[model samples]
Target: MESPDHILVVDDDAEIRTLLRDYLERSGLRVSAAADGRQMRAVLSRTAVDLVVLDVMLPGEDGLALCRDLRARGAAHLPVLMLTARGEETDRILGLEMGADDYLSKPFSPRELLARIKAVLRRTRALPPGREPASAAATLAFGAWRLDTVGRHLLDAAGTVVALTGAEYRLLRVLLEHPQRILSRDHLLHLTQGRDADPFDRSIDLLVSRLRRRLRDDVREPRYIKTVRNEGYVLSTAVAPQVTLRSTAPTDEPA
Candidate 1:
């Protein structure tokens, strides 16, 4: 039988850690609690955690720094769900920019946290229905970049491997799969995040900006991902699926 998903809860507050541990365990998930970044690292070093529930406020090496460190250390595919006491939009954006998969403000319902955890896990572990598996094609080439689908990262023109967060990889893969087509924010959100967007939701836009940075595309004049004024965004280039060895390098070709 498969083991239950293991979650590592990192928060300075002992009460909150205990609360989440008990709550999550009761919800059919294996739970581990950490008091701060040090403990968080310790748990990760020795455990095979499926997801990390990290709090923005901590004693030392705050959650944002920790999350960024995780990404830098090649934990790009590991899912992270952040928790913050502040409900400000800046905090949310910062969390996403730091490579967090999702964020929840404090005083949140345990049920809601559980739901978000499941969503992040699902998004990380499997692609939605009707989507081709990443391994189907070794790479999807567009412009000066090629997505190493098997590695779940991007390769630049010089063959530099650039890591991608789980969310960024999913968003970019969706765009690559449907290159030259305009995808609405709601559609992209549902396809990549497994949820519909609300009127005030700007996560998809933020994700696009992050992806643009990864692709080194200029915001003022992006050649790859172009923004549609009122509709959505589109990859204004042709995508080629490369499954076998090729003699020549890929070149940019407009779709």
Candidate 2:
């Protein structure tokens, strides 16, 4: 039998930690709690955690910093669900920018948090129904970059590997699969994140900006991923699939 998914919960609030631990445990998941980044790291070092539920406010290192650090340490594929006391849009944007898979504001319902956790895990572990697997193409080439669908690495013209966060890779893959077509923010959000975007949600736009940065595409005159005035964004380039040997360069997560 497969082991239950392990969750690492990092928060300074003892009550919150205990609350989540007990709540999640009741839901048939193995959970470990940490007080801060130090304990979080300790747990991560010794445990095979499937997901991390990180709080933005902590004792030493904030959740944003820790999340960024995790990405820098090549844990891109590991799902992270960020929690923040502040309901500000900037906090959510920063969390997403730092490679968080999902964000939730504090004073949230445990049931809701559990739902989000399951949603994020589902997204990271498998493709949604009716969606083709990335493995269908060995490599997808567009412009000067080639994406190793199997290995999930982005290769440059010189075959140098460029790290991409899970979110970035998903957005890029969606664009590449539907090149030369305008994709509204709602559509892109649904395709990449498996959810509809709220009126105030700009996660899709932020993801596009991050992806453009990864591709080194100038925002003003992007050769690929062009923006349509009010509709949305498009790849504006053709994607060619190549069955080639994968890059041997060392792979790391996005910083």
Candidate 3:
């Protein structure tokens, strides 16, 4: 719709990749393609891409392994929308865990695929700019391991970094911002999503449920975030601000 934006299509199936390439071009977006991880890396080395349309099942390494590798090395930051044949809920959850911004099952319409791509890109572009790089703080320690918000990464009692989706991070940030203060669903929805809180939607509840599971906090008796019944939710612990990352060259490196 807007001018042509470059998108990389990575899938072992050449037919699907070709079809998407042409369709995306017709939609006013330029598209690149890769058959596997190696080609994906080669293309990445040569061309700049805005977003990636990736398949979970690849030739050699699976998509999740690649996602973790990219994060560890800080190689790429492009938002990814996964395409998968698995229609199970576990597959959907795993896709999110693999750093996919969004997902779609097989037998999806190309128009629907386009819509999902747009949604993922829009959501990713909307996140606030972080003060530091993602790897700056792997784990944030606030009040015990009960409250941790190190940008996209949270931490547990064992000090292991916890993976959080974009929405979960945003929601957690909102609660941590006003710890101990009661914020209604409307306020939270506006603060975190910049959208009106739906009276009937359970998006917030679902995110909280996922977060609690990862944090190892029981929903019945929470220690970090507590439910206020009709009002909303509040962080039960205190928050300490993140410090700026420092260069370690003894402050004598040449400018």
lDDT of each: 0.87, 0.86, 0.69
Q: Which wins on TM-score, candidate 1 or candidate 3? A: 1
**Ranked candidates, highest TM-score first:** 2, 1, 3
- Per-residue lDDT tens digits for candidate 1, residues 1-255, read 878999999988898888888999998999999988889889988978899999888887989999999988878888999998755777778889999988888889999999999999988878532134433546789988898775678899999988888899999999999999999999999999888887877899999999999888999999999999999999999999888343343435210
**Which candidate number maximizes TM-score?**
2
Clashes by residue pair, model 1: none
Q: What is the TM-score (0 to 1) of candidate 2?
A: 0.91
RMSD to the hidden true structure, all candidates: 5.8, 3.7, 6.4
Cα displacement (angstroms), candidate 2, residue 132, comes to 12
lDDT of 2 by residue, 92-151 (tens): 999999999889987899999999999888777663211344334368999898987766
Alpha-carbon shift of residue 200 in model 2 (angstroms): 0.9
Candidate 2 at 10: error in angstroms? 0.6
Q: Write the per-residue lDDT of candidate 3 for residues 191-215, one digit (tens) a residue.
A: 6545564345455666677677766
Assess the local accuracy of residue 104 in candidate 3 as a C-alpha lDDT between 0 and 100: 72
